[model samples]
Target: MSEVKNRIAVLRAEHKISQQALADAISVSRKTISTIETGRFTPSVTIALKLAIFFNVTVEEIFSLN
Candidate 1:
């Protein structure tokens, strides 16, 4: 189905934040970040909103469906 997920990875790298750092910032486990980046997990809207707020970008910029 060619689903798309986790553009947070790219943005995270651009900001030079480690997975653990982001996980801490977002109050999730580091493995959760890994799962999310790998598309094995989907975050709630609140998490998505937190991520967008952390990155200073829109939620749509962090996620998309293909």
Candidate 2:
């Protein structure tokens, strides 16, 4: 099986936003963003879509299997 990975941190940095800021924008918790960023938790499809929309990118651009 492929391992899932994401570019959330990179995107956040590029946008000059913190985890809490992202979470607030997406209506999630800061801890949720942290866990996802650290690979300790994988976000649900809803959250993934929210992030993509917030960053003006496709979901595939943010996440992939490696």
Candidate 3:
């Protein structure tokens, strides 16, 4: 399977928010956000949508198949 690539860290930095803050905003755990950012976890569609909504961007803008 192709690996998933993401710009989550970049987006977080650009938005000046920590993983914990983002997780709280999205109603997820900080560890979940951290795992996703580190590429150790691939978020579900629901989580992806939540992240996109939180960032005011598209899921495609945050994640891609590499």
Best by TM-score: 3
- What would you estimate as the lDDT of candidate 1? 0.90
The Cα error of candidate 2 at residue 25, in Å, is 0.5
TM-score of each: 0.91, 0.95, 0.97
Query: By TM-score, how accurate is candidate 3?
Result: 0.97
> What value does the lDDT take at residue 58 in candidate 1?
96
Order of candidate numbers by TM-score, starting with the best: 3, 2, 1
Ranking by lDDT: 3, 2, 1
* Whole-model Cα lDDT of every candidate shown, in order: 0.90, 0.95, 0.96
For residue 55, what is the lDDT in candidate 2?
99
| Candidate 3, 1-66: lDDT as tens digits | 999999999999999999999999999999999999999999999999999999999999999999
True-structure RMSD, every candidate = 1.3, 0.7, 0.5
Per-residue error at 9 for model 1, in Å? 1.2
Clash numbers, per candidate = 0, 0, 0
Q: Candidate 1 clashing pairs?
A: none
